[model samples]
Target: MNSGVFITFEGPDGAGKTTILSMVANHFKEAMVTREPGGIDIAEQIRKVILNKENTAMDPRTEALLYAAARRQHLIEKVKPALEEGKMVLCDRFVDSSLAYQGYARDLGIDEVWSINQFAIEMLMPQLTIYFDIEPELGLKRINKNKEREINRLDLENLEFHQKVRDGYYLLMERFPDRIARIDASGTVEEVYEQTVKMIKDKLAK
Candidate 1:
């Protein structure tokens, strides 16, 4: 049987990861697509509790642990099973988001957040990570244009926080150069999708 492949898409807001992931999922017949704090029933419930707008007073550690809990459940119930059966899993976000959003941006420290995630994921790292490159200012601009969307609390963080997230991602890239690929996302949807599709095909061919 072919070894299962785990690929993740990650970036700051407005990098069009959703759009690109959707397109790639449709094209890949064997792909099991999912997003963080979701993908399974239990995880989805956790996602609702954590993401609810009313929980403005939620503690940072509480939030970080919740994200990890959701991830653990999702990986156990959905991701690992698919991988065992040799299915390609295309995750929209993974542990990196935690290291960036909660660890770095929330001032939790990457090491602390990663320690928790280590327990959650047990080192089930993605085989490939596609990092969408977009400037912080442009990303926030995209959020501004989408007024209908109920913004998450993380979105309310200041530019400094977002910049820290970006820097964290860069640090992650440095740490995993062979596994991560940076793609310029500030292009036409067609352009970005085409490049991403080609990369996935190339990797699968290997």
Candidate 2:
């Protein structure tokens, strides 16, 4: 069986990852493009709860668990099946989001958060993860300028929290440099997309 290649895209909010993914999807027509927190029906419901602006009352651990729950359902229902069929699975976000947003930014300890995810994912990890690196200030500014972008609970967080999320991603980069490819996201959409496509091509060539 041709167990397919799994790739995930990650970055702080408003880094244009979703937009880039949509464009990338156009280029790779055969690839299955999806996003975490919401890929399948069950997970989409969880995504609504986790991202609702009214969910400001949610505790850190609760948020983490919710994301994990969504990830589990999405993985079982979508990701694994695509990979088993030898398709290129391109996900917008994965465990890295939890590790950054909840684990590091929320001060829940990466190892601790990882322990729970270990159960949820059962060690299923993407072969490649593209991380769009950006400054929190610029990212948040982009969010504010984009009126159409969903204003979620995480988007409302203070700059400090977002910075922590970026820092957390940096730590992860250090931890898994080989699997996680970092791309500067401060440029225009075309530039970022070009860099991303090059990275993907390089990985595919390997």
Candidate 3:
């Protein structure tokens, strides 16, 4: 039995997940908000390499490994400690991002990527995961409109690849229906945030 609750927010780029997560974090005074690959010093260094646009030659498997490595370090340095202290840990992304982006979208085989991540996380899974569902085209449009947000390496991926990432999220949702909740992210930010809060509150009520 885990001592603290782990909740993850997952979505394709431009899905407004980060925006909503920030709002939700503020609402939950006891919650600790963090993101993958850069939540801690070691992980932040790994994140820089992974998101470097110049590293186009990086292999799909290599990208997956780097993400897992960063994830492991973040979990050790930040997430687990917060959880141990009985704080509600709200992470922006977790293993699902790897499964969707690298495993399915990159043609790395979901099962194969999952096996490696299993080793990284040591069976530590989120108690709840909220997936923001949106069309890939619309998501990209949102990203393009948001000039303030940094355009990362993943943002440069083509539309077809992003579509596959969305599909991968859906597949994972089917696999973990009890843990993953879908929220339509096409609406206004306030609308989406309300839905997110409701989900989190409902989960906590249980």
Candidate 4:
């Protein structure tokens, strides 16, 4: 039997989550560093379809379900096996993104989206989640500067929707304070990294 810890990074687009996740994973890259819905081969293909900008006609529910489906495949093909082998699984984004973006931001209702996701993962949840906190406007500004970033179906959402996503994450933080830690992402990268490192050190120590 494997005994490993599962950690996830979460934040709105352009919140520097991917950068932080990369550093965190490097600290233990010998284990595993993965991302949702596309960490594995098959799931990556689904990721392309889901994030394609041409799919402008995609329904909200369809978007949510696609994310869930991709998550399921990633969990089965990558996350689970890593955990079962006692590898450190550091993932960039996970179920919380769905809860915040698709569930609340998309106005799908957290409970409703969660119910659908339950079928996808069989209730497997991340042991620890680091929420990178930043204002929606600032995050969007950052995203816009990165031309290479995928501005797809979800990225086209309005400011109001992004705000709702931030609010939704705050709600989850309050509801699951024990499992989710908030880090101020507005700070300098070094400052943010130090705070995150401290938080992880504390969690691991416990």
Estimate every model's Cα lDDT from 0 to 1.
0.89, 0.94, 0.95, 0.86
Candidate 1 stretches with Cα past 4 Å from truth are 147-150
- Scored against the true structure, residue 62 in model 4 reaches a CA lDDT of 91
Better of 1 and 4 by lDDT: 1
Tens-digit lDDT track of model 1 for 1-206: 23689999999977888889999998996799999879899899988888887888999999999999999999988888899899999998999999888988888999999999999999999888999988888888888898775587677778887888888899888988999899999999899999999998888888
Candidate 3: stretches off by over 4 Å: none
Q: What is the TM-score of each candidate against the true structure?
A: 0.94, 0.98, 0.98, 0.95
Deviation from native of the Cα of residue 137 in model 2, angstroms: 0.8
lDDT (Cα, tens digit) per residue for candidate 4, span 5-67: 788899987799888877766666565888876898888998899888889888889989999
Q: What is the TM-score (0 to 1) of candidate 2?
A: 0.98
* TM-score of model 1 vs. true structure: 0.94
RMSD (Å) per prediction: 1.6, 0.9, 0.7, 1.4
TM-score, model 3 to reference = 0.98
lDDT of 2 by residue, 1-206 (tens): 43999999999998999999999999999999999889999999999999999878899999999999999999888999999999999999999999999999999999989988999998999989999989999999999999998899999999999999999999999999999999999999999999998999999999
Show where candidate 4 strays beyond 4 Å: none
What order do you get sorting by lDDT, best first?
3, 2, 1, 4
